[model samples]
Target: MNLVRSELLKIRTTSTWWWLAIAAFLSIALAFAFNAWVANETLNGNAEELGVTGDQASAAAQAANLYTSGQYLGLMFVMLIGILMVTNEFFHQTATTTFLATPRRTSVILSKLVAASLLGIGFWLVTTLIDLAAGAVFLSANGHGTLLGEWAVQRALLLNLLAYAIWTVLGIGIGTLITNQLGAVITAAVLYLVGTQVVGLLFMLLSNLLNSEAVVKWQVIWPAIASTVMVSEGQTDFTPAWWVGALVLIGYAVVSGVAGVLITRRRDIS
Candidate 1:
C-alpha cells in the first residue's frame, strides 16, 4: 500500500502528468474537429461522394466513431504516460532510492503497475468526457443531434475506456522491459504508430498472395481490430470474437509484464 501510494505521489509531483493532460485535451479537440468535418460533409449531401453513406453516416455510427476517436488517435500519448511513469524513475536515477525504500522488487513493480493502470483509467475518463462534450456541440450544430444516449455509442465508449486501460498496462510493461527512457518511448511510438499498421498491411498483402483466409484471421492485427469492432459492432469480415481480442491483449500485457519483472529481479540496480 505504501509503495503504491509512493508511486502515485511521484506522478502527482511531476510535470509530466500535467503535460499529458494538456496533450489529451488537445487530442480530444482534434477528434471533435475531425468528427465535425464528417458531420458537416454528411449534412451537405457530400457524404455519399466521400464514401460515408448509408449506415456509415448514421447517428449511432457517427457517435461511436467520435467517442472512440480519442482512443484511436490519442492512444500513443496515453501509452507514453504509462511508459514514462516508470522510465522517468530510471532516467533520474531515482529507482535506487525507490528500491531502497521498498526492498522487494516485486512489490515495487506491482505498485507501478497499479499506478499506471489508474493513470490509464483517469486519462480515458477525462478524454471521454471531453469527446462527449465536444462531440455533442459539433454534432448538434451540424443537425446530427447528440447521440450519446444510443446503445452503440455507449458500448463503444465503454470499450474504448477498457482499451485505453489495457494499453496503459502494456506501456508499463514496455517501460519496465526497456529501462532506457528515450529508447522505450521511441520503440513504443514506432510500434503503435507505424509498426502495427505496417505489419497488418504486410499480412494482408501476404494473405492476398497466398490466398489464405486463415492467415488474415489469425494475424496480430486481427485481435486489435476485433477488440474495437466488437465494441463498436462495426461491420467487418475479418475480426475475431470480442473475447478472443481481450485475451490477445491480455496476453501481451502478461508476457511483457512477466518478462519485465523477471529482468528487474535479476538485474543489478546500480
Candidate 2:
C-alpha cells in the first residue's frame, strides 16, 4: 500500500509527467488540425486530382485519418514518461532505499514498469479522444463526412489507441534497461528516430539494388513501423505484418525488461 501510494505521489509531484501529457496533447491536436485542413482542401478539389471522391464519406474518412495520425510525434511523449520514471529513481538515489525496503526486486521494477506504461497510455488515450471529438466536429462542419454512424472511423481510432499502448510498453522496457535518465532518453530517441529508420532505409535501398527479398524484411527490426497502423487503410507500402511488428516490439520490451531485472537483482544498491 505504501509503495503504491509513494509511486502515485511521485508521479503527481513531478513535472515530467505533466510535460509528457502536454506533448501528447499537442502532437495529436496538431496532427488532427493539419490533416483536417488538408482533407478539407482535397475534398474541395476534383476527385481525379487527389484520387478520391469528393464526398461526405471521403471527408469522414479523411477526418478519421487525421485523428489516428501522429504516432511518430506522440512516441516522444511515451519515451519521455518511460525513461524518466525508471531513470529518475537512479538520479535521485532512491533505488537504494526502494530496493532495501522492497527486497523483492522484480516487484519493484514491475511496479515502475506498470506505472510508466499506464501513465503513457492514459495520456495517449486522452489525446486520441480529443482528436476524435475535434475531428468529428471539423468533418461535420466541412460537410466532408458524418460524425456519427461511421464504424470504420471508430475502428481506426481504437487501433490508434492500441498502437500507442504498444509503443508505450516498448518505451517502458527500454527505460528499465537504461536506468539512467539521459542515457535512456538518448537510447530511446536513437532507436526510434535514428537507428531503426536509418537501418530500414539502408536495407530497402540495398534490397532494391540486389533484388534480395531478405533485405525487405527489415520492417520487423522495430515496432516503429506499426505506428502507421492507425492510418493508411486497405494496406500500405512494404512493411512487416501487423502481428509480426507487434511481436518484434514486444520482444524488444521483454528483452530490455529481463535485462533490467537481472541487473537489479545483481547490483548492490548501497
Candidate 3:
C-alpha cells in the first residue's frame, strides 16, 4: 500500500500529470469536433446511398462513433501516463531507492502497474463524460436522440473503458522495456500515429498483391489497430471481429507487461 501511495504521490507532485491531462482534454475536444464533422458527413452520405434499414444502422453507428469520439487521441494520452510512470524513475535516478525500499522488484513494478491502470481509468472517466455530453447534444439537436439505451452504444462505452485501462497497462510495459524516457515516449506516440497508418497500408498492399483480402486481417497485430477494432462499429471479412481485436491487444499487454517485470527483476538500477 505504501509503495503504491509513493508512486501515486510521485505522480501527484509532478507537473507531467496535469500537463498531460490538459493535453488530453484539448485533444478530446478537438477530436470530438472533427469526429462530429465526420459523423455528419457519413450520416448524410449514407442516407443518400442506402435504404431505410441501412440508413438506420449507419445512424446508429455514427452515434456510437460520436459517443466514442476522441478515443484514439485520448488513449494516446493515457498511454503516456503509463510510460512515464516507469521511465520517470530512471529519469530522476530513483529506481535504486525504490527497489531498495521495496526489495521485491516485482512488487515495485506491480505498484506502478496498478497506479498507471488507475490513472488510465481516471482518464477514461473524464473522456467518457465529455463524449457522452457531446454525443447527447449532437444527437438531440439532429433529432436522432442520444441512443444511450441502445446496446451498441452501451457496448462501445464499456469496451472503450476497457481499452483505456489496458492501453495504460501496456504503457507501463513499454516504459519498463525502453527505460529511456524520451525514447519510450516518442516511440509510443509516433509508432501509434504513424505506425498504424503505415501498417494498415502495408497490409492493404499485401492483400491486393496477393489477391486475398484475408491479408488485411493481420493488421490487428498492431496494438493501435487492435484498439480501433475493439470499438469498431462495423466489421468485414478483411478484419477480425471486435473480440479478436480485444484479444490481440490483451495479448500484447500481457507479453509486454510480463517481459517488463521479468526484465526489471534482473535489471541494473544504477
Q: Judged by lDDT relative to the true structure, which candidate is superior, 1 or 2?
A: 1
Candidates' C-alpha lDDT: 0.74, 0.67, 0.84
User: Candidate 1 on 1-270: residue-level lDDT in tens?
Assistant: 778788889889989889878877877777777876776776677878867755556778777777666565566776788789889888999989888977889888888888877888888888877778777877788677898878878877877777777777778888888889999999888777686677678878888998876676565443345445545544433455445666776677688678767877887897
Q: Each model's TM-score?
A: 0.85, 0.81, 0.93
- Candidate RMSDs in Å, in order, are 2.9, 3.7, 2.4
List candidate 1 stretches off by more than 4 Å. 39-57, 142-144, 211-231, 238-244
Scored by Cα lDDT, where does model 2 land?
0.67
What's the lDDT for residue 182 in model 2?
88
Q: Is candidate 2 or candidate 3 better by lDDT?
A: 3
Q: lDDT per residue, candidate 3, 1-270, as tens digits?
A: 787888889999999889888988898888889778767766666544433233234767778778777788888888998999999989989888888888999999889888887888888898889999988999889887888887877878888888999888889999998999999999989998999899999999999999999899999999888887888666765667778888898898788779879999988887
**Steric collisions counted per model:** 0, 0, 0
On lDDT, the leading prediction is: 3
TM-score of 1: 0.85
Ranking by lDDT: 3, 1, 2
Among residues 3 or more apart in sequence or in different chains, the pairs in candidate 3 whose N, CA or C atoms overlap within 3 Å are none
Record all residue pairs in model 2 with backbone atoms less than 3 Å apart, i.e. clashing.
none
